[model samples]
Target: MDKFIETINWCSLRDIGFVGPRFTWLYRKSDGSQIRERLDGALVTSDWLNRFPSAKLFHLSSSASDHSPLSLRLVPKPRSRMAGKLFRFESMWLKEPRCAEIVQEAWGEGLREASSDVLGKCLESGDRNTRFFHAKASARYSKNLISGLMDAREVWQEEDSKVEEIVVDYYQTLFTSSNPSDFVELLQAVNPR
Candidate 1:
């Protein structure tokens, strides 16, 4: 048993994790003291971990078997999430007495430049506005603030969800090709007859 333990330790294998309830194994003694331990689980090597970094384990309710049967899966990599709806700050927060104090404290500490990139971007967008000038000494801005927004892009495609599926399918084939010739062939094949 000791040599077997050493061999497992030396192999550098790690147990896959589980979510939900903690214990997996249970035993009861004649005197009524119960024993519970995570006796059943799967382990993987470094190579397996790198290949399936998002792998997970789940604990299930015991039927006839004392220990939970485990499952393993390697999921396809997910695409980058589209920027969704804007989150609005609550007006009630400003009404509270502590609001001023909290704001002053946060302001005193000063936000890091890296943390305020989005805010800086919105502020800097002022320069992107087109300026119009007339020969008669009139300076007016001709910026259409709503241009290039989602509603404009979505007009080209009736189904918004299909756009991502199309993009993902297109890129997956191109990127997964191992050879240049294969990529070129795949690209040519994508065009309709």
Candidate 2:
């Protein structure tokens, strides 16, 4: 065991670029001689460390397994034209008198007796009310916009082009006013250069 530890320590010093918190792992055995030794290790090339400025290895406490898990947090490289933040609706918007009325009216009859045009109008008004409500609600919640954008970007990447286009169009409709110039300007303002 001593020889093994020495070999690992030497190899780690030579190969692992970043020497983090010395203690890496713990050990427990049913045997009378309970030994706690660093069982888990992390090794990264110098170039990899340089590439990921925020990268770090964390030795977590052992739960069920004898070996502790090593967590790596890497700072993603900057990208051009990141996704715009999603518009989050606030709960308070439901408290607004007009928004409350629109929601109540739209869902009142449950769209059973209404004609196609009536249903369409109700949906449009309901959508507008919901959007307004959420905007006000989001202000209070103070949700992280960057994280939301990152998640949306991931989804967009996995989707087909047509699906991605539809999502973009939907967001445009939800976030921008009816004015074309205003919409374009708003999009440019949110998108990265």
lDDT of 1 by residue, 1-193 (tens): 9996787779867665664357888787999998888877777765666566555565666777767666554563343443663343434344444556565665687743332343334335553321211211111111211111122233322244655555666678778956554477777789777
Q: Pick the candidate with the highest TM-score.
A: 1
Q: What are the per-model C-alpha RMSD values against the true structure?
A: 24.6, 23.9
State how far residue 175 of model 1 sits from its true place (Å).
Answer: 47
Prediction 2 TM-score vs. true: 0.28
lDDT by residue (tens digit), candidate 2, 11-119: 5322222223345555556675656666566555434544554454556655687666677757553433456644333454444446655555657867423333443
Which pairs clash in the backbone of model 2?
89-134, 90-134, 90-137
How high a TM-score does candidate 1 get? 0.37
Residue-level error in angstroms, candidate 1, position 19: 1.9
Question: In candidate 2, which residue ranges exceed 4 Å CA deviation?
Answer: 1-24, 29-33, 76-193
- What's the lDDT of the predicted structure labeled candidate 1? 0.52
